[model samples]
Target: MPLIVLCGLPGSGKSRRAEELREALSAESGGERRVFLVAEVAAGEGGGGGRAALRAEAERLLSRRDVVIVDAGNELKSFRYELYCLSKHTGTPHCLLLCPGGAPRPDRPPLEAPDSRNRWDWPLFTAPEDPSEPLPLPEIRAALFERRPPPPNQSTRSQPLQAAGFLHQLDRLTQDMVAALMAAQRNGVGPGQVIPLAVEGLGQEPPGLLLSRAVSLAELSRLRRQFLSYAKMHPGEGEENLPQLGSMFVQYLNSNLL
Candidate 1:
């Protein structure tokens, strides 16, 4: 079972989809295999320490499960790539499930979390993956401790923290990282599968609506249409009818990551 890295912005239904995928995979496995969902939000500490803890826990969980679904925003390319490297180090097949949400709205502001030094986010795990073989833990440790080279230029050495400035920076970073992933995909060195899913009406109702009173009826109505369309596309068992979505997931898994 591969480590399925859930990628998307906040409120893109990653956790919900993770549950659906877990159920689908387990059912296919005859209900005997265990699938664990490790949410980055639950990682709590913020910054590298938080990420390190999350990865450590994921590694531990992987040891005892048939599949491990890492549910996180993973908004940065470097972070996603770092995960790819970790999966390689552990000799586990890894893939990405890209979940893009609706257009960003000013009313729906992102959390103002502490900024992570992109260059140092994963100081201990910076190497790229070798799909053919996993590296030895001793060598990985040595690489982590060894001095790293300076950045090729100064721009990447620092970034502005203003809200607008940061969002633009994030946009550029995501674009670059996605392009790299696509290149790697073509080269047979990227994720096993880059599943693209656009989830509509994310902020309109139910969980989101309850949390945010700012959501207007118009927004809610629009969201309902989106959900209905999605549901129509995917009919499944139970109230959520997520099996349809699960079917799409399984179909993607069948494709070669290369």
Candidate 2:
């Protein structure tokens, strides 16, 4: 059974649509497949806790012969991504139902709780005077609900390099390393000069993992070796210097060689 997450701002008919879709799915699939509608508010007091509760509910529903529909205003990208990851982890197909119109639901009363860490504040999603029409069923099925293929070369050996911030720095370092290598090669400078030049290029720490992807294996190995050698020579150097060396090596590869 697949999990469908409906995300939209408040007054966008997410709850109503979820109900309609649930009925449609149940009717289409027959009584053999049940549909569980779980709301975050019923499970917790805070948004994070609510999300965790929703994840747990989805996890439990996965074992049953049913399709789980999460009816909530999941406006944040991070929340949606986490749900996506959850669905993948549970080995269930996932779909996102989005209502772009932002139409107000007259029947659904406003949430009374204050917008704080403890409670959810249903934000107003003011519909445009002439709201754009919803995407066609074919397009929605193809674009929004379609399953994405797993990435190529999914290996456990390269796990540490998957951090986004490290990848970004790795990319920058690859370019710099490549440049230094090229410059050294051109000027007939040996490995001694090339190593220091590469180290000097990779100075700052990367931003954050949420913003980038992993560096390739070839790049990682080259950087790792350079840093290990550097560490051997400068025993008093902080562990933080290791990543800088890695980044420089990657930068060199990206810019000059690959």
Q: Candidate 2: what lDDT?
A: 0.48
Which consecutive 10 residues in model 2 have the weakest lDDT in total?
116-125
Q: Could you tell me every candidate's TM-score relative to the true structure?
A: 0.39, 0.45
Tens digits of per-residue lDDT, candidate 1, 70-139, equal 8876654435544554554454555555555634434322322212232222232211222233223344
TM-score winner among the candidates?
A: 2
Q: RMSD for each model, in Å, please? A: 20.9, 17.0
Report backbone clashes per prediction.
Answer: 1, 9
Clashing pairs in 1: 192-257
Instruction: Quickly count the clashes in candidate 2.
Output: 9
TM-score of 1: 0.39
Angstrom error of the Cα, residue 106, model 1: value is: 11
Candidate 2 pairs with clashing backbones: 164-212, 173-247, 173-251, 174-250, 174-251, 174-252, 175-251, 177-252, 178-252
lDDT (10s digit) by residue, model 2, range 1-258: 666677665666766676766776678667887888877666562434565677677667763256787887665443454455555445455666655446435422222222222101122122222334432334333432355522222222244433434444544554555455445455554432323342443445431111022234465456445433322222223345446445433332322221
